[model samples]
Target chain A: MFAIEANGQKIEAKKGETILQTLTRAGINVPTICHMEGLLPSGTCRMCVVEVEGFGGLVPSCSHPVAEGMKIRTNTPEVMQTRKTIIDLLLSNHPDDCLYCARNGNCDLAKLAADNGVRDRTFHGERTHRPKDISSPAIIRDPDKCILCGKCVRMCEEIQGVSAIDFVNRGSKAYVGTAFNEGLNVSSCISCGQCILVCPTAALSEHKYIDEVLQALADPEMMVVVQHAPAVSVSIAEEFGFKPGTDFDGKMVAALRRVGFDRVFDTSFAADLTIMEEGSELVHRVQNNGPLPMFTSCSPGWVKFVEQFYPEFLPNVSTCKSPQQMMGAVIKSFFAEKENLDPKKIVSVSIMPCTAKKFECGRPEMGRDFVPDVDFVLTTRELAELFRITGVNPAAIEPEPPDNPFGERSSAGKLFGASGGVMEAAIRSAYFLLTGEELKEYKIQDLRGMKGSKELRVKIGDLEVGAAVVSSLGQARKLMDEIKAGRSDIHFIEVMTCPGGCINGGGQPIGADQEAIKARMNALYQIDRDDRLRVSHKNEWVQRLYTEFLGKPLGHKSHELLHTHYEKREVLL
Target chain B: MPTVKSVETILKEHPNAGRDHLIPILQEVQESEGFLSQESITKVGRALNLPSSKIFGVATFFNMFRFQPKGKYHVMVCRGTACHVKGSGKSLDMVTKTLKIQPGETSRDKLFSLEIVACMGACGLAPVVNINGQFYAKISPMKLQRIIEECREKEQTHANA
Candidate 1:
């Protein structure tokens, strides 16, 4: 390790670490993507160029190794010129598709291009044109919009350990894609959404559901009920000018009402209900020797990846629909029954931070009692737009309580937004259900926080239950791979698609740096702490739902409405 | 510890390659294996997922990937304004003929992949070639070829045993 003064800040960096890594670790982000932590530094973009005191020329900070006592100026005129030129060069080849581009409003390259004062894409040459690829069930790849930055390449090769795609050609003919231009859906590519998350352009983006949602909201005969995921509460506030990790549950409810949602429910309600079904299923599976390791199926990205790549492990996957879909089913069935609304006329909406939720809602398996469970899925961004277009300022809107039955939930439900939150919530309920007593230790502090990928063991009755938690779709791949290999000792696992879980979802407000993401994750925990009804099982509404309507967890009625099964995708690598 | 030239030296030697083609060369190197094993390729592929094979194909197919294994010594000659004005192309030709490989092709011994890149953006260092990550300025054709020979000899001695 060496210490250096960069931009008047003392930075301690590992030997051979680049200036960009040092600066990023020190929280001074110089725009970069081709320089992820583990990948080789390809200084082709020259975006991280910096001026040094002794060095006469501007150099790419991303490739330059840190040395002891190196005096570096990040914002010199020469450096700025180099950066501006680089941005101009990139913009020349970049397509002006921001308005229609899926990565619009969130792309790093677009943000930087805007920040760097790019007036035009100076080059008047013929634009690179390639067809859009939407064949995959989970992801879409548009070649014409690709900036050819290797972030996706590095993310796949170095991070996810799945070298499914790479830069295939060179010069004016260069492209980033699979071998022989194979469709991503057909290739060994796991639909982890990491590539989508890392792509600097709209070249890679999840299939969107904004149009379907818009149509549903416009249908006069339809009663569209929406539910926001737990993690969405922590992050949706960011879009409304609230800080990341702010628990804007009340404000989000207010915004949904203002957006003219017929009913704004909580997916946490279903997440709590998921615990009731999945937990009971786990106990049955364990006792019956059905599957040793029952993997959580909350993340559609992970589920699709597993179904496609590791089909042999299908038995291990929990059959319960993800809370988003589960809530959809319950909405159309249970809620529709209570309200005496025709099932066909009820359109259940989901406001999720997940791109895969769009895919999950369209699944043929989602229909129950002749009605498709969830009619429309909206990312947090789309929902925010609804509030905006409807002229509802979420910040100024008065906070109000949610509707009856599904409105009242627990802190256990709230924690479902963060990693390990689902596991913790489930254990809180399952342990008590088995022991026939409330857990005296209310704080299951063991399963909490942004610890990256973690594995913990706890004794539930005579059996030692091994549980693991992972955030970040890429990290989940590693955990899933280990579980598939039978090397993972965990009996149950929790996987959240985004890093820091829903608090830092892809559709959340833009510009959440690492610190902001961590802060929002903490806010979710604090929200859990402040709630009096912390355990999902003990929530009065949940108790009544079982005692008054559904009878018991995993019973015939609960299974019909709250619980569902997963279908095996026929694709194999 | 072999006699290695800097990245500048390799670039100076290869006359035909350019800045727009650097990514292709890097991609080719990575595709040959799973990753960019050499630091030169790593530096070259930074910000681009330049699998070496893809880079090589692009380099050769569109004139960019360096087919040569990067020697402990890489010598890149800048064909940018300063270097071009100072006869960087002539220096690159001299290195290429001496090494007996095209701009992107490596020697059979696997010691070096010659590459010609556009402006290092260092207009002051005309006719510049970075050898083994070190900058070598004011290099004529004769001087550039000698650096390649010296690096080749060092690799030969190391491999002889």
Candidate 2:
């Protein structure tokens, strides 16, 4: 703990806690959006400003740390007025159509406006109108509703480590978005959807594939198969007003069945497949020296981040497709083959906690046999909306089981939804594949848990495998800079665009504060520890998939179904 | 490059470069060499033990930093809310027309660099343009030509001296 005095208040705080954290812990509320305690302090939204006795002017309390004997003032009339003016300025360009907005009933920005008693748009001028970006399959961006508070940017940069969104200009004209207001579909944006989770308004939201799913259900010819990502089990219950970390896997299956989907599939099965492909890819890379840093491509945000900022390191990214995309490809190829249905007729719908999945599904590179692996991507909220549309009360539904083959997933596959789980799952399999011996030392200690940046080198037989894991894009930037400068010796890096992995993806349930998200992450980690079969290779279903369908990782079948390429494009509105 | 190093040396001698170095370093380099150069980035990186790419990354990332060298005289047009309401865009358009360069672009003659900044924290003055740190208030399209002619005269005289 660090000792510090702020505004004559003697306080003891964690050594690393920011001034905002110390102040908040001491009962002082600072106005800020991009500065959640668990997340990185963005310092982009400069609203939580305070006048330090020694410092000349007001400093942003969110990023600034308290010093010994420091004087801090909460309700200085000047500070209050400044805050009001900032809010007023933000409201000027913001859309007044909150009544019809998706987040009307539950918007933090709206609540702030009401709490502050701000009644008018003081700066009346010609609005800098930007068209809504609805190009992606999962997320939507209504620029008019954006306050430029930078919560979305921070979430993208810090939590996801994707760095997909950023400030384009300076001051009032400055807007938060991809390069030239390019739709997420075209930009190097990974579809993690963490940006949507932290956004204060409906400026960024999940693309509603729920409507498409409904349409498919309405069309009797469409055999709509719904797949739930592993993280969805712990989080989907929240939409039904159930507590976070609740295992609603049964309820989810029941809900999908009730909603009239032909099959309710577990993405965990595909996740198990990912561990096989990705884990094997890691070993192949380490052995053959294909790419030193084989980055995980599961998180779209990380993929996009690598594409935009670190294009030189693109080879480092694993060619293995994400679980959603892998499932989509297989559902179109293998599932369609096995079920005796045309690939085009099998409507593959994925229920994700990500907004980025919408964009990922629409990628030109995602098509195999001229059919996108996943036809539609819906966030947990959109699924909730679908539940409402179908008139299915999740609470009233009877718990059911997912269909066979794809339904058989180990806890290793289930853990893929969280941060460090991918690396953990991959190493569990990779260690065995490389050494031809059971890994008594299964845990890759360096690749477990969240920090600004993590780097480690481990010996796998004769080869020393180097790896790095970073949750936030800001941290990714730092790591990337290190890589660019030839400072990083890492080989197989696992980067999840979302901070706590897909469990805390962008399109998850709204209003999930720092504590709520952390609780969810902790629960997933516990599940990973509790599971008897914690290795992907140990999953019987995965072994069977390799034996029956896919011959090997990076093999012809694997490449056809589990690997994809990236294209660099200039983003335009 | 020498100019950037000199400025960095000067900054190293200053009191508070530890925490508030990046902005100050940028400001000093811009002052000494008319804008931030690739050389300045390398020097800063070497001095700070920060990566040269990181320094360049930070410079390019911020909107405030200017990458290319500018003209001897800097002409800035205010595009704040008050200024915009009073037709700062039209005023900027006129400046753009006369200078034969867009906002943020310097004239090939090295005589002027035109830029548009928001507000300048001066709202009461309404539409404002600053020439080499000297404020010109309530500027319209017609008044812009005279200002340009005056800047030309001042630059010519200063050069002669």
Query: Candidate 1 lDDT (Cα, whole model)?
Result: 0.73
Highest lDDT: which candidate? Answer: 2
Error of 1 at A183 (Å): 4.7
- Docking quality tier of model 2: incorrect
Error of 2 at A142 (Å): 2.4
**DockQ for all models, in order?**
0.08, 0.06
* Model 2 native-contact share: 0.00
TM-score of chain A of 1: 0.90
Which tens-of-lDDT digit does each residue in A57-140 have in candidate 1? 777888888778988887767777667777887777767767877666678887887777767656666677888889765578
Candidate models: Cα lDDT each: 0.73, 0.75
- For candidate 1, write residues B1-161 as lDDT tens digits: 33444544544454466557575444544444423334555345333434333333343444443334565556677888878888888988887777777665666766666777877777786778987678887888888777777877877898896
Instruction: Give me the candidate number with maximum DockQ.
Output: 1
- In candidate 2, stretches whose alpha carbon ends up further than 4 angstroms from where it belongs are A1-19, A34-93, A117-128, A135-139, A153-174, A177-192, A287-289, A309-312, A395-398, A434-437, A440-446, A455-464, A480-490, A552-555, A566-573, B1-161
Per-candidate TM-score against the hidden true structure? 0.74, 0.72
How many Å off is the CA of A52 in candidate 1? 4.5
